[model samples]
Structure formats: C-alpha cells, structure tokens
Target: MGVYSEGFLEAVDAALADFEVEIRQLGAAASDAQILAAIERVVLALNSVSQGVAGGVIDTDEREQLCLFIDEVMTENGIEVGELAARHGVSRYAITDRWRRW
Candidate 1:
C-alpha cells in the first residue's frame, strides 16, 4: 500500500483543479472521458508547476512526470494515501490499490 500526506494531496488536488480549468478553457467538451483525460494531463503538468514554482515557464511534460514521481515519493514517506482518492469518485482503497494504472 502506498501513502500520501494530507498536505501533498491537497497540493496535487489544487494543481489538478487548475489543470482542469485550463483544459476546459481550451475548448474541450465536458464529458467523463474528457474530464478524466484533462485531470491526467494536469497531473502530468504538475511537474511544470513545481518547476515554475521555483521560477520557470512551466514545461507541461515535466509537470506530468513530477506528479508520477510525487506519488512514489508519497508512498515512500509512509503517509496514509487514498483519503483524497475519494475526491475522484473512487474508493480510497481503489485509489491506492494499483493506482498507477490510472
């Protein structure tokens, strides 16, 4: 089982929301798949946001990679993950269970 701290999850959620808003602004329709895809893209974009936080223009690819990396880090940190997973409309167990497939 992987873990994720509350703070980290909050940051990720905030970042994901930002990413979703941007995608919608780009003219993507409001569908289940589109929403999900937009979220994934935004998570990927988290790397860029992290970089930009340190003074950069936000490389989109970097953001994606950073998010993936963060999840691993969260697991290593031993923070109880899955609580925030429910926000995505899935069970906390499912979110933390083999979540990489998402």
Candidate 2:
C-alpha cells in the first residue's frame, strides 16, 4: 500500500470527484481501457496542478486559492515548511511568509 495520508487521499478524491460527471460521460462511449486511461490522465493533471502551483507556474486569480488548498493539505499531513520550500526550490521563509498572509 502507498503511504499517502488521509488528507492527501481526501484531496485526490475531491479533485477526482470534480471530474466525475465528465468521466462518466466519456465512459458511455469509450472502451473500459480507454475510460481507465482517461481517469489516469485526470489524476496526473490534478497532480501537475499542485506542482505548478508550488513551482510558481500558475499565474491567475485562482493561484491563491490553489496555494491555500495545497498549504492546508501539507499542514494536515504535517509536512515541514522547509521540506515544502525545498520541493519548490524556494526558501523556508518564503513558505512561512505566504502562510502568514493566509
């Protein structure tokens, strides 16, 4: 089994739920394998969204909301500030500064 936390799993589930309708629509015409592949892509895209937010690739009004979601998930999972900073190639202070404003 994977070592994902409850918070992380919940986040993934929520993200997937957002696409449930579309996925079901595709399932109507697609083969089972194709449907599965589409679901996998959705998961991958959701994962990329988080990475993009962390690496500062996203630049829109929604960025702050996405950042806050990421922060909440990380906090719930007990991820250290320094670890998140290192993952994003940023400083620990930068992470704390953003959190402080939230």
Candidate 3:
C-alpha cells in the first residue's frame, strides 16, 4: 500500500512536460519503435518520481487512496508537478514546497 500526496501530481506534471519534449524528438526520427520507446521513457520517468514521493511518505492502504486522488487532480489539470519541475529544472523539494502553498 502507498499514499499519494499533492506532491505526486506535481511530480507527474513535471515528467509529462519532459516526456512531451522527448516524444517530439523521437517523432522526428519517424519510427514506431522510437515513439514507443519515448512513451516508455516518459512512463519510467513518472514512475521514478512517484516512487520517490511514496518512499518519503507512509506505506499503507490509506496512502494508496491519497495517490489516487493525486492522479485525479493531475488528470483534470492535464499536468503533473514532477514534470513541471523538470520543465523548469527544479528540485522535488521545490515542487513539494509549491504543494505546501495549497
């Protein structure tokens, strides 16, 4: 089990931005495998950020619910904090700080 925090959304958003850029670069290569690889890379990036955030918090069913909520928010906004942070070249702590404001 794992908990999701606002930080999670931030992390995903940051990763998404990077992923989009990566997809574009791969798109220029014009290969299906390259595009798929780029997508997988984005997923891995997001997974890495989520693992980091989850590791910092408690591990339990309650935490999983929280993470679900975070995913919902990210979906609505079509962005993620981690991805945004990466786009801006900032630290996760900085992304967490932004969440603290909320």
- C-alpha lDDT values of all predictions: 0.46, 0.47, 0.49
Sort by lDDT, best first: what order? 3, 2, 1
Count clashes in each candidate, considering only residues at least 3 apart in sequence or on different chains. 8, 0, 20
Write model 2 residue lDDT over 1-102, tens digit each, in one string: 334445555555566555554454543444534433543454465556545333323334444554455444444434454564676576644543332222
Q: List residue ranges in candidate 1 displaced over 4 A.
A: 28-45, 48-102
Error of 1 at 20 (Å): 0.6
lDDT tens digits, residue span 1-102, model 1: 234455555555686567545544634234445444544565455544443343333234544454554444333434333534555667533432232322
Write candidate 3's Cα lDDT for 54-82 as tens digits.
53333345334444544343334444445
TM-score of 3: 0.42
**Model 2: residues >4 Å from true position, as ranges?**
1-13, 16-59, 91-102
Poorest 10 consecutive residues by lDDT, candidate 3: 93-102
Ranking by TM-score: 3, 2, 1
TM-score of the candidate numbered 2?
A: 0.32
Using lDDT as the yardstick, the better of models 1 and 2 is: 2
